[model samples]
Target: MRGLLPQLVMRVLAAGLLTVVVAAGWVLWDTARAARRDAQTTAALVSDAIAARPSFEGLAFGGVAPTPVFRDWQQFPAWSLIAPGICVELGPRDQPIQRRCGPYLAAATPPDWFVWLANRLGLVPEPVAVPVRTRYVSDAYVTAIADPGVIVTRAWARTGDLMRVAVGMAIGGAVLTGLLMIRLLAPFGLLLRGIEHLQRGDFTGRLPRLRVAEFDRLSSAVNDTAAALQEAQAARAELTRRLFSVQENERRALARELHDEFGQCLTATRAMAAAIAQSGESTAQDGARIAEISGQMMDSLRAELARLRPPDLDDLGLRPALERMVANWRARMPSVRFELGLAGPIDAVPDDLALSLYRIAQECVTNAIRHGTPTHIALHIEVGDAITLTAADDGSPRHGGTIDSGYGLLGIRERVDALGGSFVLAPVENGMRAVARLPL
Candidate 1:
């Protein structure tokens, strides 16, 4: 979501820029083409106007030169008011008379590049010759050169004006597009914030409905997922609480039975056997054997009870209990090297969390020894915003073949999940690694 806004903005800007560029190019091309056509039309009109003069008509029908009507027509000041771009020249074919209204001689003509561009686009008009008949001469004509630069320059000016308008339109369109994009993506921003909340474990947060149907549907889906996660978390927490209660009760009952019933009976039998051995001579050897057997049974029962629930975990705290557990494993498998790294305030961890972490570690070590046949094992625990436990072993990952599922891994996963944690078991360089993370 954080990245989405910038990405969308860039896309919109790119598309808008492309449209503006293409439209501007098209406008320029079309303007030049229309300006050329207008120049040609103006040139033709100027030629027609020159040919319509009465003097020119009489000359064409054989009227004599230097006549009064011809002189007046040639000297008419009204010719100066002819179409602005046309130059009227009055004279015989071989001799020049006078010229009027020419854009080339005008003071306000455009620059060379503008004229060149206009001329290239066929905007420069050509001369049109009108012939007149003289009684004494076979060939005589008046030439009108329409200086299309006047109309072409005006057309170019208009084109420039239209181009400015086009640019304005393009800028306005880009601005509007930006505003529209922001409006359309507003719902996505809301969705993004909601997703961020979910990532931070605030599953109670829900996305609001948006005006767009598609966005609304997406929001609804995200809300539904959050709701489901919230419910599932609650249910899992309850189930974990109940499971812990049941496990504690079972441990207490078993410990009580082993201590109050089995322990008392074994003690009484050992006392009787010791008395029998001390009192008699012939039965002494048999009594001694019985006493030894009963004493061994009591010691084994106590060890088993300790394994079920270590008293050190309750009285001495987690560190000692974990150290003792690891030491016992090292003693059992003297060939396997074990290393433990505990950082931060491990002793301050809650009893339940400590116990769960201990169990998970215990399972990982057991699995590594039995399946991985590891020669080296490393256990690392870090207590921070969350508890992270990592176990790595250097041994055959597959043992003799592919690893099979067992109650050990399943129990570890269930315990971690119950504590609202994640567990992963994967093959590492030499053997296997197990990692677990639990929120505080």
Candidate 2:
């Protein structure tokens, strides 16, 4: 049980941790993606700002008379270099005359990411021939003047550095959250231990309040379950004691009935037979009367012996006992055809089990003969781990009813149930079926 608890806890904890990890990781990844998107958008705006400048737009090396150099420069004067590490430049491919519009020197080339962005924005034709290295570039933008000039700019570098810092914080937060979950779940182990102790018949331990409301409720439920189980055990023990007491009393009464009633009747019959034999008569009529009286006494004696302890049960076990019972029923009701199929041997059964099974069968047959008023009755018995006795017949039920709680059937049910067995009475396809299955 102790070994089992940790496995259960691990299963629960793993499920909870997986849920948290999936949710938190999704949020972190989405935030990172959104940050990268925002960085790119900012870079594009800065590049466009630098590109729309008059002097930077296809300006020749010496022809600068069309637009003033310093008048409209303030409107878009390399604001792409507004932040640290940002740079922008406009260079002509014809004469290699580069105008430094932004913060960095014109000799510097923009990062590869900026060149790719420039091509995607249609500032240059497909497949720009610039050789550039691959690296993490948060945001950069570039523009080209069809083959005459190319402008490149850096923007949102500060946003890139901020994103890196945010990623670090997100990872640290995830670790800290996982640690907190572990701490919160630690008390669950205590609750589990408390349940284990209760299962091992130790109910003294009380779990300390975890301060978590949910855990507190769980602890209360565990304590209640332990209390309920203890109460049920006590009640069951008391009921068993009462049932045993009743059984003992019944056994004592049966013993007394056999010894007092049957014993006295047999003793008187034996004495009467001896006296009649000693006082023999010579007349043939008197001899015949004496023989008849003796025969009646013997038959009565046999019936008394059978009542005290059924001789058929001892002689042929359950099968012959049921057969004799069926024969007796047939003799009593000449109109009824009683069929008996004692299917299997029942010799190995204990005394109590045999008695319970025989009583159930006798009661069911008696009920059928009394109330069913059937033309035919069938009795079937088989013994295995349990004794199954069934009495089915083509007869109508009593009380103008198809179903009722008759005394005999009720007694059979009570007896079978007392011995941890099953009793069933239902209408079969042809007639009613009475069944008692008692454990051997």
Candidate 3:
């Protein structure tokens, strides 16, 4: 859990960067294409402007041109314009016969656009083109071509320069976008820290209110959950303290009951038997009667042990425990009737929960007998992911005041609550019903 946050953050950042890169790359590609098209258009326009001028025809002839046309052309510095170069006029046999005004050619292979335009314009053997640098110029120079071809070749160079600019902007944009994302995501760090503190059993921290509405709601929800958990933990601790106290008292009570009741009775009975055997006056009938009484006393002691220890709870299980409890109740009040709906051999409940269930039933029965004075009682035990024990008595309520609860009900409630269960008592027709639901 401690390492979960860093791992989540890394995953989010990796995904974000990947998405941004893919999207930005696509956008940049489209921008490059659009820039190339615009460059081509500008290049054609500039070439046409130069070629349409009367001064350019004389300039092309080397017909004593003024310095201004050359100066003006040089001053037009733009990505679209193709640089000046030489051309050629063709003779009847389609051979280059004269040089035309243009810049010196420099390219290992003529640009494809240049060759296409020259052929389409019927300017065979006379090539017009944009010069590209090479180790050595091509032997096929001074040929016919047109201005558009030059512009097309220059469009590539201009597009190359625009690509560099686009790349710089894209990088800067990606960095800025990353930073903004980090800022937006920073509050989640606070939320995660709060959760970590809660996980470590520190539920006292107050979450900071967030500017984002959803985050604010989340912070509030977490604080509420923490508060509830803290309260529950405190209640559990208190219950445990009380339970241990009760267990210690019960242990002492059991020890005292054994020593004072069973132990003293056995010792007196042993002395009486010894005297009867030693005395000549003692009759055989008297000895038999004493032996019978001693046997009964031993049986009683064994029964008490069985009641206290409850070995059958582990062996015969919850069904027997509950049956024995009901039998004991019947013995105490023979006239009182009970209808039990025991869901037997219930899917093996946790040992602690089974004990709690048995104890809660005992408490309800005892309460019904002592307070409700009910002639009839109903008991039901249900089992599943949780266990529910319910007991109801149909009898008149005590008229004077609310019945005060003794250790019986308190002990049952403590046990149920210790295991994170709920206990409720409600009026059921003419009597009261006690219900306990414990998580298995």
lDDT (Cα, tens digit) per residue for candidate 2, span 1-440: 45444454555556555655555445444533443443344345544454454343324656554432322424553444332222222222233223233333333354677456545543322211121111212122242222202222322232344445665555555566556667878777989898998977665567776799999999988888777876765665457446644764565567567657766765666566556656665554554556567567667756655544566886677667767877777786899898877656666777666766776777777777667668888888888767788888888644322233534766576566566567778776657888788776
Q: TM-scores for all candidates?
A: 0.58, 0.39, 0.42
Please give the ranking of all candidate structures by lDDT, highest first, separated by commas: 1, 3, 2
Q: How do all the candidates rank in terms of TM-score, highest first?
A: 1, 3, 2
Question: 115, model 1: CA deviation in Å?
Answer: 6.0
The runs of at least 3 residues in candidate 1 whose Cα sits more than 4 Å from the true structure, single-residue gaps closed, are 1-81, 88-99, 102-120, 125-152, 172-176, 179-186, 196-202, 208-217, 236-324, 337-355, 367-411, 422-440
The TM-score of predicted model 2 comes to 0.39
In order, the Cα lDDT scores of the candidates are 0.72, 0.57, 0.61
Candidate 1 per-residue lDDT over residues 66-168, each given as its tens digit? 2323444434454333445566665665685766563333344556786677677555545555655444334445565555656556655655666667666
Better by lDDT, candidate 3 or 1 = 1
Measure candidate 1: CA RMSD. Answer: 7.9
Model 1 TM-score (2 dp): 0.58
Residue 276: error of model 3 in Å? 2.5
TM-score of 3: 0.42
Any runs in candidate 2 off by more than 4 Å, and if so which? 1-308, 397-407
Q: Evaluate model 3: give its lDDT.
A: 0.61
Q: Which pairs clash (backbone N, Cα, C closer than 3 Å) in model 1?
A: 59-133
